[model samples]
Target: DPIFLSSFWQELFTLQGVLLHKSTAYHPQTDGQTEVLNRTLETSLRCFCSDSPHTWATQLPLAEWWYNTTYHSTLKCAPFEVLYGQKPPIHLPYLAGESSNDMVDRSLEAREAVIALLKLHLTRAQQSMRDKANKHRSDRQFMEGDWVYLKL
Candidate 1:
């Protein structure tokens, strides 16, 4: 059943522009950030479903919202804000008195600020990741016919 499901998913994702990479069993690094995101989502689900695990499905949207609103160490900004250029406002009865036009203007200004910050954060994160990765890597050259053991 799982094999069939996996095959179905592979087909579905490929059709949706997702790339599938074959990897050795138990190798999380092969998928890079996808593995990290899965761990984070699992942790969030566990926290949300402590009392009723069956309710996890109902809590998924809330988990997604929390994840999107939470700041990432590398990104230095909430995922939603980075993508949309502004953070979604929390419910505030007091702010209901403000005119819609004023709110729009304020949101636009905040979005511009956030976009600037996001660009800076992205650059810094990229450089840091490159430096860290290079530290663990070695420079090597291989001839066309050279045999190298590929780690599965």
Candidate 2:
């Protein structure tokens, strides 16, 4: 709270176009998307820091990078893609005891799998949006002499 209330923090937020809103106690629904992202980031951090815990600070950057590179169904691409106007650069992640060739193959396979998953997610998201939009819509017919708006 003190950090957010500081003049420096206020200026930084203003520069970034971030508007801080007062959150209600025990009301996560008010910021559903933010809450979802927080939960995801927390889960990823927990996974990364489970062994060392104290090494979370070191793992934070990698986790952040991984998150930015991951595909988003709504966006139809990773956040990195939107910001950089291209896909995240491909690289072989370190795998203990694996040779360079094996690592390269694994990296390629992982990317292919991620691409497939992104496609699947996009299809589902589209269907969900269509269903939600259809909820308030109905087929209508107009005929001669049907009531319609007229300019006075």
Candidate 3:
């Protein structure tokens, strides 16, 4: 199952113009931020909804929206806001009175703004991932008289 899933992930990445370079899997650490967020989501939904076990499927999206729109414990800003420098439009109501239909013009401007923000987010995320990977490699590099596990 893992082999098949790995190949699938590789293929998916290849479609995105990325190459799969495999060596050994790195041990995962329990990052506090992620753990806290997961716990918050689970607890919130468990307390809020009790009708179905599939409640997670319904609540997860809302939970993500709330989480991303609210300030992070460490980051000091909402995750989406931090990434994009502003929160994306959550909900809005249309007004009844309009003369020249400025709504269309504003919508186009908003779309262009979103595209620009997305490009910026992608660039930043890529750089962050690259930095983490490089740091991991540097930390794991074997030194003289140091013992390391060989992945055989």
Model 2 pairs in collision: none
User: Which candidate's lDDT is highest?
Assistant: 2
In model 1, where do residues sit more than 4 Å from their true spots? 1-29, 91-152
Native-to-model Cα distance after best TM-score fit, residue 30 in candidate 1, in Å: 2.4
* Model 3 stretches with alpha carbons more than 4 Å out: 1-29, 90-152
| Model 3 TM-score, 2 decimals | 0.38
Count clashing residue pairs per candidate: 0, 0, 0
Whole-model lDDT per candidate: 0.71, 0.74, 0.62
Across 1-152, the per-residue lDDT of candidate 1 in tens digits comes to: 35634878879987999876676667778888779887888877776565567877766776677789888888889999899999866733233225568776665554344334545656877999999999989999999999998988
Supply the global lDDT for candidate 3. 0.62
Best TM-score goes to which candidate?
A: 2
Candidate 2: list runs displaced more than 4 Å.
1-29, 94-152
Instruction: Supply candidate 3's per-residue lDDT for 130.
Output: 97
Candidate that beats the other on lDDT, 1 or 3, i.e. the better one: 1
Q: Write the per-residue lDDT of candidate 3 for residues 34-135, one digit (tens) a residue.
A: 567678888655543443546456556655776678777688778898889886676543333432577775654544443345456558779999998898
The C-alpha TM-scores of every prediction are 0.42, 0.44, 0.38
